[model samples]
Target: MSAVTVGQELASVPYDELIKNILLAMVAAQNEANASFIEGINDLVGTEVKIKYKEDSTEKEISGNALAFGILPTLLQIQSGIIEIKMAITLQQTREFQVGVKARMGFRVFSASVDAKYQNTYSYKVEGSSLVRIQVAPAPPPQPLMRAIEYIASKTAPTIP
Candidate 1:
């Protein structure tokens, strides 16, 4: 084997920075892959997750501050909801970690939906008009009172000598 000779040292990067870069890349990839889901999540944040039974059974929901959090939390909640969903999807292999499925009995099935959201305790509106309109209006005409104002004679009349 021939010995290699170099005049300058090789460039080195920090593990923390490398890890951060990898994490950012993974996050970006995840966002891209689940673009629609993310978009849906953003829109559905602050809304209720409702599960309804028979028409005679009335309604059920998870709402208020708990549901009004930001998109990330909402997405996480939705992710957690997979178990609540009880529907198997993306399963092909026998592996339990890779979106696999199994059969179960006596599990209740419910409808999931988004409800009107008034405000989120954990989230705020980031996009909207910030400038406030300054309005000025002329003061209202003085009203007649017992002693507040005296009716004066017309200016067109002159005082007699």
Candidate 2:
């Protein structure tokens, strides 16, 4: 409703020019917000902090995206010998961030991956003993008392005819 009102108010401007103006305004607003947010991040750069965001970069004509992470060292005891990672955020500062954006954007759209599988899966209770069969089952682990008793009997028992 408010958007509609604002659009109606801007009707005096030409349609194409109005759209361009709106986009320009949006970009300006985004940059200002980002600068302020980065400044905040810079404040706690030397401290232990974990921040998660999406990184996008373009090199030549190719572009890629990934989950960007920033972690600060937690061990203050070893600060003398250890190198700590810090973040710097400056409001309205002139900086060309070619590395990528560090903003937290919600609900990024991604294409479904084609049958990517996870690694390190183990199944203990297999049914088929053959070469080409896969089985999955859940079995309880052996009890410690029974194992101890078996061990003692084996060690102490004498041979019988």
Candidate 3:
């Protein structure tokens, strides 16, 4: 008896299709009952605080839709504070956006780098077929809310437990 090895296979998915699917899924998830849909993510990576979203309205919609989906995405806009640590596409199809550290405070730190553009072509394979994969960029690093809490804490003295 001879042992034969077969390579794994992948699925075929189009970039545009993938993006549309993700957007649809997001909408669907938000529409789902008792489903918590997060439109935005906030966190404290370091000294800098960052907020990201395709549009601020997305957050409002998420908040309003929270009742059905159980989660809402909020639009975050930090006027003065830290800089954006990471940039993600979240949903990419016709256009390509790089994910990385960008500006700080109000000043632009790094020049925008175009790793891939709308013309760029990329593909993925799954289940023995090419799967269209939309580049879902990582959410921006969350801003630290500890400072606000600390400020409040400092204002108020600790009481006995």
Candidate 4:
């Protein structure tokens, strides 16, 4: 059988809260130039575009800090019913895990590492005085393996005894 491993879970924050916070962080990061463009688009689109995370938490705690990373376009252009913002923010964190094993004969201990990344996309329109139709797309999912461990079971079940 293959070995089983799991990562550490956050203490008390809900997933939705995490995503909301991250999205807010992304919006706050936008500079004046891009913010103006976002506002303009909101005016054109009737409905506001917002970002929603499919999972519980889009923000991962790595090391000791809470970080949000993403990409935004340096220049934004609204033309022919299409709006584009071009830039990127790459955020990542590393965590460590400890594993312990006890058996009839002895005990063993080891460590594993896990890393996570979050990428955000900023594009929006200005409707009236409010920024509407804000769309934020998360980057691809984080990889599962931050570290790898391998071990042989004692005698491999003895070949069916």
- Candidate 2, residue 137: Cα displacement in angstroms equals 47
Q: What lDDT does each candidate get? A: 0.30, 0.30, 0.30, 0.29
lDDT of 3 by residue, 77-123 (tens): 32232222111222212212435523233322111111233113222
Error of 1 at 109 (Å): 53
TM-score against truth, every candidate? 0.19, 0.23, 0.21, 0.19
Residue by residue across 34-97, what tens digits does model 4's lDDT show?
5674454334232322343344655332221011111222344222232232212112221234
Ranking by TM-score: 2, 3, 1, 4
Comparing candidate 1 with candidate 3, which one achieves the higher TM-score? 3
Q: Which stretches of candidate 4 lie over 4 Å from their true place?
A: 1-12, 31-161
Give the top-scoring candidate (TM-score): 2
> After TM-score superposition, what is the CA distance of residue 9 in candidate 1 from its true location, in Å?
8.5
Sequence-dependent TM-score of model 4: 0.19
Residue-level lDDT for 17 in candidate 2: 44
lDDT of 4 at 19: 44
Q: Where is the poorest 10-residue window by lDDT in model 1?
A: 80-89
